[model samples]
Target chain A: MDNLKIERTKSTPYIFFDAASGRLRVEGESYPENVVKFYTPVLDWLHGYFAEGADNITLEFKVAYFNSSTSKVFMTIFDLLEEYVTTGRMIEVVWICDRDNDVSIECGEEFKEEVEQLSFRIEAC
Target chain B: MNIRSLYLEEEAVLKRAEGLLMSQQCFSLDVYRELYEEYRKLLKQMKTLVNVADLTQAELKTLSEELGKVSRIDGLTELYNRRYFREIFLHTWQQAVEEKDILSLLMIDIDYFKKYNDTYGHLQGDECLKAVAAEFQRAVGHPEDFVARFGGEEFVILLPHSDAEAAIDVAKRLLQNIENLCMEHSASPFGQRVTISVGIACRCPTSDVKPNTLLDEADQALYKAKAAGRNCFKLYV
Candidate 1:
């Protein structure tokens, strides 16, 4: 499997997925003008990898700010992770939030509560 | 496994990627082609969606601009309101002091306006105020000159980089403009028509003075104009 590296822009976040090492990460602010357009390929790649039946997956997130549309996309990704874990696959999610920003901390906590199948941890930075 | 830059969405490039992934392990060539084709269809759909988003963002920008303009305007006079006037004058005062340039202010009021409002009803009084405000708005000649509705029956004009002479010219033009309109005010002593009293103040702004100082000087001059009899302009010395 190949590693996926997408560069960050003013509106979109950086994505670095090392499929071989099983370390996937998304970092930076995400308020893209076209949320669905920006993230469709990312979902496609993740689904492709999942088809091969992964043993263990660790997804890390370091998001500063995101809008309503981007939140919907994040929920979709969480749904995929839930599906993966339900099949007895080991999936760990690490969501990073700045200590001073309560909104982001709340978002991470909500994700933890909502996605039951995955082991989700909120790490304050 | 090779690292790939993921922005590229060409069909040929995606097909090659699918070939590489299929070569890795279990995916057959036919299955890989189907996956690649599906991805290509998704990219085309995203392009269409992005075009729609661009239109929505443009409309949002226009709406915000209109809202900002509305906030800065006085609804009755259709001129810049007191808050916007104060915000701009403070900055202009600072700039004038830094550059050591001249600044002028004109504080104007309608003669016997309270009596006029009493005699003609508040509705007609509002119409008279609107007409007078339009005259003052027309008298402002330069882009740097601004006129604002200061309060009931009072208006203020700010002229940046204007000397005493230029300000007097503006005052004269404002008097002529209002006179030409010939708005009726039966309660006025100045004339049969509504007329305005103006007080002019000018300063080569310095670090020691503030915006309120200019306003106070103009107010004192306006009092002097009233004492000297209405329908005339007084310059603060």
Candidate 2:
């Protein structure tokens, strides 16, 4: 599976997935006009990575702000990872939040609570 | 990966899902339960997202208001800056005209401030300016009165409903306050202690009279005050 790389915009986040290292990173704001259209390639890359029999991967999320549609996309991504975890794959999810932004920290905590099987950790910086 | 190809692939998946939902006649009890749980989780996430956005919006509003106030204030003296003063001065002038009240402007300068800076160094000169600014702030008791840093070593006070006599009383009070401070200004020819020169201009503003007219008159009076001698005030006749 080829790695996915997309630059960030004023209302979107930067996406980078490394096939060689099995590391994925999505950072910055996410409020794109068409949320589903923007994240389609990212969802495709994740599906392909898991289908290619990848055993372990680390996903990092450093999002400052995101709209409701972006929230739904995040829930979908979490469901995908949880499915892989239930199939006996190790997936580590790290959510990085700003220390001063209580909202971002709270959102990360909410996501962590929703996923049981996946190793989801919230970190503040 | 080609983005177009990936987008097409996801579109196909979405179409398939739509078809599955359309064709499905009934779902098993376990499937229904799982869907209900997912719906609840989504609702909870949605609530958090909305709350986060609201808080961020409110925080941004407060930050912008604070930035506005900071921009209008002088950093060293904590007085209204010249630009902001100019904006509000016009409003004050208009209000005085509408009310048919006397408006007075006092142009004040520190006597031989350059010499003070040279003798005591820039740091002490800054302290002197701050002290004088504080004294001016304390002396202006009226709620409608405004004090501003007109520029380097110069300050202006706007007095509403005051005539020449009232303006002179304010000048006297300011001079007395500076004397109480008793700041040493060895290089000043005016006196051993720091003193200020004030120029007073009073008028009942009219619609035809521009706001700048009063300001110019005050400036001219300040020049006369300096020429006559420092450390005292002179009223524009």
Candidate 3:
């Protein structure tokens, strides 16, 4: 599978779903005009990755702010990772937040509580 | 000469009509003609008024359209508003059902909000709400996710192509982010720190599950979170 890289804009975030390194990194703020229209392709890529049997993935979320629509997309990514973990593959989620920002830390903790097999950790940057 | 003659002619006609009505004791053709002319004049005046009314109606419609464009807030809290959320939710739900993608929802609420409002006034309470809202907006990080301010101090996040466990994880992260804020809420039931409770629900777009039902399930989980504690999250069974 080919690597996917999306640059961040005023209205969107930076997305890097790398196939070779098995690292999916999403950074920046996301509040696009049409969120569903923007994320359909990203969801497709995740589906394609799973179908191709790519294992040993690490997902990193380094976001300052995003809209409710983006939250749903993050759920989709985590769900995919959960499936892979269920199949006996290792999946790790690294949640990065600023040191003083309790909001980000709390959000990371929330995501961690939901998943069972996937390893989840929160890091302050 | 012309003005004098015209005035004299009108007066003569009026006099003749009165005379005919009195002497003939019957309605004449000339009287009918004069009445018809008066009726035509009134009709023309009414037509002009009607045209002005139509113009005012058109102007009002244009003003309303302009106001809608300027006054409507598409997204609040840096997330989608209820209006945008409903549109995307329906669209994504349909697509996920058709394509067999994972779909999920998370309902989030501020813990001890009433206490917060009591301790810090509604102004500060609103500030806290805005801060948390910004955090939720940042969490999704993708276009596919839908985050919306469901109501005061409450938010809903939609995750497509996700499962139950992942949805739970996201909820946990949101809780952690808010907790880390350390926004002092002395009146809170959960201690000095302000926190949130989240409820999560996920579906694979099965034939049995509808979008509203999924939301209801998530809301139930949110209720469970509130029941268990003010700062925890739960996933629907």
Candidate number achieving the greatest lDDT relative to the actual structure: 2
lDDT of 2 by residue, A21-119 (tens): 989999999989888789888888888888899988999999998876677677678878988899999899999998888877877877787677999
List of clashing residue pairs for candidate 1: none
Q: Tell me the tens digit of each residue's lDDT in model 2 across B1-237.
A: 223332333455456556658987776777667556655665665665576567666766888999999999999999999999998899889998899989899999999999999999999999999999999998886988889999999999999888898889999999999989989989876558999999999999999998999999999999998998878889999
For each of the candidates, what fraction of the native contacts does it recover? 0.00, 0.15, 0.00
Give a tens-digit lDDT track for model 1, residues B34-55. 7766575445444433443444
- Give the C-alpha interface root-mean-square deviation per candidate: 11.1, 6.2, 33.9
Ranking by DockQ: 2, 1, 3
Q: Which of candidates 1 and 3 is the stronger one according to lDDT?
A: 1
| Interface C-alpha RMSD, model 1 | 11.1
Docking class of 2: acceptable
Q: Output the better candidate (2/3) by lDDT.
A: 2
DockQ-derived CAPRI band for the predicted complex in model 3:
incorrect
lDDT of candidates 1 onward, in order = 0.83, 0.85, 0.76
Q: After superposition, how far is residue A113 of candidate 3 from its true place, in Å?
A: 69
Distance (Å) between predicted and true CA of B39, model 2?
2.9
Give the RMSD in angstroms, all C-alphas superposed, for model 3: 34.5
Best by DockQ: 2
TM-score of 1: 0.61
TM-score per prediction, in order, is 0.61, 0.81, 0.46
